[model samples]
Target: MEDDVRDDALDLLAEVLVWRLAGDRWRAVERALDGLAAAGGDTDAFREVLHDLELAGPARAVRIEDVAVLPVPEPVRERINQLVHTLEGPGRAEDDPE
Candidate 1:
């Protein structure tokens, strides 16, 4: 039951990410993230799910300016990249040792 709930939450977050990215709305993304967090989901976990969605190729990537009208910081981008790597799992990356 816990696993099911977690998956459902993550799936919702992924959908929200795709929606926000499609509409080029960073504020919407942030609001969705906050709502998820308030509902007992981890914000960082949702961010990771967003990265995974991007990696899975269903979500379109947008320029920082397209989303926020300003440059997104590199650290945040790196965090997203790291989330993708983490969610993609071991042995999924060609360079992964496992």
Candidate 2:
């Protein structure tokens, strides 16, 4: 039940980010989405991001003059940050064997 709520919230956030984001932020969002996918984030949203990337063709780094400034609510902002942190996970050494 709790996990469902989390997934739902992340899905909603992903939906919002997908439609509202533009410019350089799109690249960051794409990376974050990729990390989220690796971190076991929502499948539906992840699939959508993958589809979007496919439609967008090869990923290229670019910067344009116009950039959208998304005004996220505090709670939503915090939640998104938390999700990214979860995606980041523990700070472990690359060569460290568990």
Candidate 3:
């Protein structure tokens, strides 16, 4: 049950980030998602990120500038950051040995 809630929140956060991230941040974010997938860390979250990345490009193809400037509410950004930290897991840096 706890895992489900985490996964769901991670999914929503990933989706929001894919669309809301400013400038070229999405590239690094995509790379992070790829790295997470390669490391087999949270398959569900990886899939969610991929799904949102797929939609994000075309969804903002025309109004890219407008969407780039669209403000993400402060609360949502904070929650997303919290979910990202949870996804990273405690005492588990990217270089840490499993």
Ranking by lDDT: 3, 2, 1
TM-score of 1: 0.31
The lDDT per prediction is 0.42, 0.46, 0.51
Instruction: Highest TM-score: give the candidate number.
Output: 3
Candidate 1 stretches greater than 4 Å from native: 11-24, 41-98
Reference-based TM-score, model 3: 0.34
Summing lDDT over every window of 10 consecutive residues in candidate 1, give the lowest-scoring window. Answer: 16-25
Candidate 2 has an lDDT of 0.46
Q: Total backbone clashes of model 3?
A: 0
| lDDT tens digits by residue: candidate 1, 1-98 | 14554555445444433332333344444444444334333556655644544443323655555654433334334433443343345444345332
Cα-based TM-score, every candidate: 0.31, 0.32, 0.34
Query: Which lDDT value does model 1 have at 73?
Result: 32
Name the lDDT of candidate 3.
0.51
C-alpha lDDT of candidate 1 relative to the true structure: 0.42
Between the candidate structures 1 and 3, which one is better when assessed by lDDT? 3
**lDDT tens string, model 3, 35-95?**
4445345566656655554444424344545455444446445545754674658543353
Give candidate 2's error at residue 62 in angstroms: 18
